[model samples]
Target chain A: MSARATTRPGGRSARVQQSVHQAVRDLEAEVGRDALTVPLIAARAGVTPSTVYRRWGDLRELLSDVAVERLRPDTAPADHGGLRADLEAWAAQFAEEMSSTAGRTYIRDALLGDPGQGNAVRCSDYAVEQLKAIGVRAAGRGEAVPDVETLLDVLVAPLMYRILFRPSDLSTVYTDHLVAAALGRGPATPQTKS
Target chain B: MSARATTRPGGRSARVQQSVHQAVRDLEAEVGRDALTVPLIAARAGVTPSTVYRRWGDLRELLSDVAVERLRPDTAPADHGGLRADLEAWAAQFAEEMSSTAGRTYIRDALLGDPGQGNAVRCSDYAVEQLKAIGVRAAGRGEAVPDVETLLDVLVAPLMYRILFRPSDLSTVYTDHLVAAALGRGPATPQTKS
Candidate 1:
């Protein structure tokens, strides 16, 4: 038996992995996390159950992999020429992603699972990376970048809290306040309706 | 049959309700929400399955009732003679509650369950009430209270986000920063390590 499988791009193994990952996402979106099963995923992926077991070990492991992939920002943060603009754009994008069904399901599963699973850590790291990207852009434009941890505490954390706990639409106004608070602009004043 | 059930406190109906609610909490703490079952709850409460069905109709309704009860802060917000002090004390106490096993379990269940279930709203309302109490006290002392919505958006929301996402203990410094941010004091500077 050969010690290594095919190394070429778009090979059988690569195709199998892609299909399986897509299957997990589709099934999760359709039926939710609890209803997901190894056999169902394998069937959906057009692979054998043994293949799934050999590759990922179990449902939880497979789900964790999918989570890590999905939790990552879909695109690079846009450089908006200023710290406040960059931060607000990033936050607005993040809040939009989190409000989606797919995003919410992935986050909820990771959080509801065991903390030792490292899913939360992956999610946190993803946020940190996005923040770092924004910070780098700000520094390039000769701006004093705010502390990442402080930004997380003030802006990102509150946005996420509203997303998960309050179940409201992520308003641009809300994201703007978060940026202002992080920059020491003060608490976001509420807009009164005319 | 009479039009009304007994209105006396600690009557049979009251006893059954208390026992069932306690059973839900105990089971959730031990086995978690996913493992919870109506029959299991009935057995733990020492009530019949029929009684469980007749009283609450289903597991979700029972859980919602329990959630409403548990999410309410047990004690009133302390009147610490100042807005900042009162806010910090309240945040500290809330953070402590959220750090415990029971508190985390309750929050996780509420978040993971259906959003339309009203558990999250009850929890948010609890925080709002606590903030209102502090605001009233601040006004009594001739101190200008920050906008209630602003306080919720900054202080309460971020504290909750930290509780759910990050596994770290809530520090006094973090709570102080939230209060400061709400009061337009500035970004809370990190405390120096001893």
Candidate 2:
């Protein structure tokens, strides 16, 4: 109804903030980032442009927040034991991130063919660093260097490639198989749907 | 200035074609795909947008052509070994493409952060098919399948991820290392620079 909506909640204006954040995600998830604008986000969130600006700064910053949320890992119970547990946990996390509608959208949008190279370059560098950090964390627990790096690469690369390139749906079993293969615990087999 | 630079004899037209093509590439190389426009391309080429439109149709069509040329592999020498050679050859082709300035721009503009999903999906699918075709050919030559694919994936996926994430220098030596590592042909210490 209004040109824009800034719905913050709590006390004076926190309600407006929460409402507007939800609306921004909704607008992007629905029509996509290309279609989203301050005006549109404001309208959906039931707030004004000024309010949206006051809170989120700009569209890029808003999208960055959404992207970050989509990428946050959902940790699993660490009881599987040995590298398998770590591998499974990591692979499942990978699958979860790539398989989500929002995650997929974010990754898809972040690639080379989208809009801005500067943003793409920065985002890609950040992701690489994220992978590197994860690799370092694994190594702290006695994982070797090339071993740790290659292990991470093998466990996650296929899932990533599948998400990017193919229609074939990879499975948790495939993830497990890959981890097993990497750990020299089993053979690497090609996967079909679960 | 004849449009048929690549077609003319004495390699004169070839030079023109190379010059104009390089001009387009340089523009992409300098500012990347986001800042790429017919006006910018024309200015870079020291021509007019009318000339560019006349030569390459529209910007989309021109870019498509540029992408095709920039990425397609020149016929390289074949190996008599087996699937490993085939896979290496194929991966090397891709690595070379991704290493070029134009290729970097294409991937950065096409698949990196904010890469449009549809375009990324289409291109990545086409790339997989291309890899599959190479594998099939390798199989015909008596190369193994499961190992070949795994080896090939190990090589290509990392390269793709690097291209997607690095957005900087790419090199033939780097591809050679990927090929070596994936095939277990030699050590892969990750020769990073250049």
Candidate 1 lDDT, A1-194, residue by residue in tens: 00112233887888988888889878977997679999999999999999998987778677766766677666678877788998988888888877776677677766655446377777877888889988988888798988777777777887777667665546787778778878877566545310
Q: Is the docking of candidate 1 incorrect, acceptable, medium or high quality?
A: acceptable
Worst 10 residues of 2 chain A by lDDT: A1-10
Q: Candidate 2: where are CA atoms >4 Å away? A: A1-23, A26-35, A40-65, A74-79, A112-148, A185-187, A191-194, B1-86, B108-122, B125-148, B166-174, B184-194
Cα lDDT, all candidates? 0.74, 0.57
- lDDT for model 1 comes to 0.74
Q: Candidate 2's error at A152, in angstroms?
A: 4.3
**Residue A157 in candidate 2, Cα distance off native in Å:** 2.3
User: In model 1 chain A, which range of ten residues has the least summed lDDT?
Assistant: A1-10
